[model samples]
Target: MTAAPDARSALRAATTPDHERVDAAFGAFDLTTREGYAAFLLGQAHAFLPIEAAIVAADPRDLLPDWPARRRGERLREDLSALGFPAPPTGDWAPFRHRADILGAIYVLEGSRLGGRMLARSVPADLPRSFIDTSDSVRWRYLIEVLDKLLVTDDQHTLAIDAARRAFALFEAGALRQKRTKAFG
Candidate 1:
């Protein structure tokens, strides 16, 4: 028989590589100026809006009943508007129709909640930060407790991990695009 899936450890291991890529890409962005911050928010908007729609469209209710509360696209949109930038024109994602894949996508968003406080602190004093708030550790712990109980097969686990990688790739691509594009005033 196949080993029982360990969602927490599997997800942790799956996302770490892409996580490092995202961190490195983010580090390259100069966040000190209004334009730089706008670009950053725009990149986030590109990634989050599409990924959020995919997770919602996949109807993650079964796996994540609290999925609605977990979305951060609105926050990204708020940051975009505050920075006088329009939303990204694209809202497409890689094929993530399966519940496992979609939940994997959602996991990236949920996990990002952990870094909001530090990211919020990164903005300069004069920057807009309506969307940058502290991570809700209570909610994170609750999600983790739920995830720990899931019993996916190794194949399903692989789908979830692949989705996470795709999610990160989407974000990294958007960030790179932002670095090359014109910033909103």
Candidate 2:
């Protein structure tokens, strides 16, 4: 182990590869089409709300004091309705048992906002794609700065890394589930 280890660094290092993988996988999804965007939002709602509920329940005010403003479940819901899609019932997710797990999940969730502007650009001018239209980066920057200061031990770092991986897998599964639904209908 290197000297002066930190949960921030350890978590980033562990998640870098996974982050890259998620970016590529998400990039492969074509959001230019109405059906594509609908499917995207469907899966997004499925994964995001459950994880958001878990972390919000974990009480993140200590770390992310602005959690309320940062929350996006409402926006996702609005987008779904704008597209005339019904919000389907999502299955239960295992609640995060540790603060580190919450942080890891939030890392994935918040990190996603950094790429939202690009996704927003992909939408047709006439379409309502507010879900990915986060043009400002202030919130994203704040989350990073706050995360950088939250001291986590090696054990916590490991758990955070695992949680981040699970977050990605959960999101992908949600998207796949939507695809299957579309195919079957």
Candidate 3:
């Protein structure tokens, strides 16, 4: 058999920029200003609520074309506020690093439960009972249960969460760099 394409090639092929495709994805979802209220509720449930929205938000960069990192963070915050969550005095969500995983968990949970399937195991039992309150989405409830069952060690979990967090950071940096290059050129 021929050798398989490497990870870089696979990623490049998978992530090829297609504005139409991106637009279509967003179009599939009906986003209203009211979504902010949903986001606020999510935020009140979990300090890390923004992470889940960030994960699924339509073309986050499209939502905020300039000053990506800051704007992206702000949009998430706005969502939280709309959902009725009290903005923290510090307005910092990074203190809670579990956000992305929580997002991922919700994704899987929603997919499995609504679709009538399951994946990535269940949530662990030892995590605080408070974790389940993070969202009104039934998906979020299922995610809390799944998150509680993750088998990865704490170190591995930390690394995974860090990597996911860095993905957003790198995305912001790349967007900024692209803008600067266009401006200077």
Candidate 4:
């Protein structure tokens, strides 16, 4: 018999489609240009601010002690302001009702940090990059460890996977909305 997948592996496998869609949507931006980069940040702020607020409302400190430091909304806002744009209006998100749900959302947010590092290289050096440039591999490792320990049941796994998919969908929708608006153009 095959050994069961770990929480991280399971979540990753279940959400790969959603992840790909979000990546494709956001990847359309030309980060090398200031307008493209600002639009990217605006879309990110639109989705992330509300999602982060919902996560905070769930009070996941017990699961993620360093949650405060992990937040990037303020950094995104700062970057937007530097580009002469105000913060985009936040949208509503369904509340995270369980620890597993919160874990799933955190998975998406932290996972994006990994991609952000790569995208950061594409961003012009003259632009503010506090949101994407911040690196914390150690925190990521800690989150993985937490997931392995806390997510031990089928129900827990399902909740996490569903939450993760929702998180990805939010980002995907946000990117499409910003792309259509051409708000920064």
Candidate 5:
């Protein structure tokens, strides 16, 4: 049997390997506190769900009844519009449509589990990576990585979730230390 692709490999395959751009985008956020990290994930979810929703719409069976995928996509698009993301009039979701099943799975496993609409709406365009022109392909790629871990793992400890939470905490701690050092120096 073929082994599932690793997260980075999946991302590289689904979207351009733009680590520099991704990191630069990530760097734009504070990521130094629980709220900051939560905001970051929600920002991703806010952007992520629209594409995810479309995929779900492509096949509604992928998610729980109330969490239809298409609605998720529409919501994401609506949220983006509400947040003033200028319409990418000519943007093509063909790439997204082609992989609807995979993207739908990602939405069910990742985007749906996030905080809530309020948190999502609270994420503004000025936030980190918020205006980096992220494509549905890139978002799907990232979501696949995150969701694959969250959904596929059998361990109840939720290694991926726990790791992500801890990683954010560590990042926040480091940011705090850096700030202190900068101030004291």
Candidate 6:
């Protein structure tokens, strides 16, 4: 009999397309310039604030004890302020109804930190970078441990995958909205 896929692998496989879409959408921003960087942060704020708020409301502490330390919404806000841009209004996000759902969203948020490291190199050194500069491999490993431990059932795995996909979609929408406003141009 074939061994079952682990939670992380399953989620990655399921959401690869959505993840790619988000990467392409955000990749259009020219991060080397202040205008481009600020717009990119604004797009991130629009999606992250609402979703992170919802995750906090759900109280995932039982599943993720370090949830408080993992939040980056405030950091994103600080970057926006430093750029002289007002906080963009957050849009409505899908609710996190289950623990699996919360985990899925966390996956997207944490995974972004890996990508953020690469993007950070593009930003001018003088600019604020608290949000993207903070990438913790230990925290990521812990999250993977939790995901593998808790997402034991196929149903739970499915829920997590769906939630991750939705999170990616929210990010894509946020980037599109920012682009539409032409705030950076």
TM-score-better candidate, 5 vs 6: 6
lDDT (Cα, tens digit) per residue for candidate 1, span 1-185: 76664787889887898999987776676677788788878877778788888777777778778778877777777777877877877577766656677767767777877866788787887877765574788878766676665526777778878888888898888888887775522
**Candidate 4's C-alpha lDDT?**
0.90
- Which candidate, 3 or 6, would have the higher TM-score against the true structure? 6
TM-score each candidate. 0.88, 0.86, 0.24, 0.96, 0.31, 0.96
- Steric clashes per prediction: 0, 0, 17, 0, 7, 0
Give candidate 5's TM-score: 0.31
Computed on alpha carbons, the lDDT of every model, listed in order, comes to: 0.75, 0.75, 0.33, 0.90, 0.38, 0.90
RMSD of model 3, in Å? Answer: 18.7
TM-score of 4: 0.96
- Global Cα lDDT for candidate 1: 0.75
Tens digit of per-residue lDDT, candidate 3, span 1-185: 76544322322243334322322322222122334223222322232334434443433233223212222234435544544554443322332234334333233223222321111122223222222223344533434444444423444344434434443343333333333333211
Tell me model 5's lDDT, rounded to 2 decimals: 0.38
Please state every model's RMSD to the true fold in angstroms: 2.5, 2.6, 18.7, 1.3, 12.7, 1.2
Spell out the clash pairs found in candidate 1.
none
In terms of lDDT, the poorest run of 10 residues in model 1 is 143-152
Q: What TM-score does candidate 1 get on C-alpha atoms?
A: 0.88
Clashes of 3: 17
Residue 56 accuracy (lDDT) in model 3:
39
- Candidate 6's TM-score: 0.96
* lDDT by residue (tens digit), candidate 5, 1-185: 88765543443343332323333444554444434543344344433444443444455344333334324444444444554453223222223322323433344334233423333344444543332222345444555554555444223123333333322333344344434433211
* Candidate 3 residue runs with Cα over 4 Å from true position: 1-136, 181-185
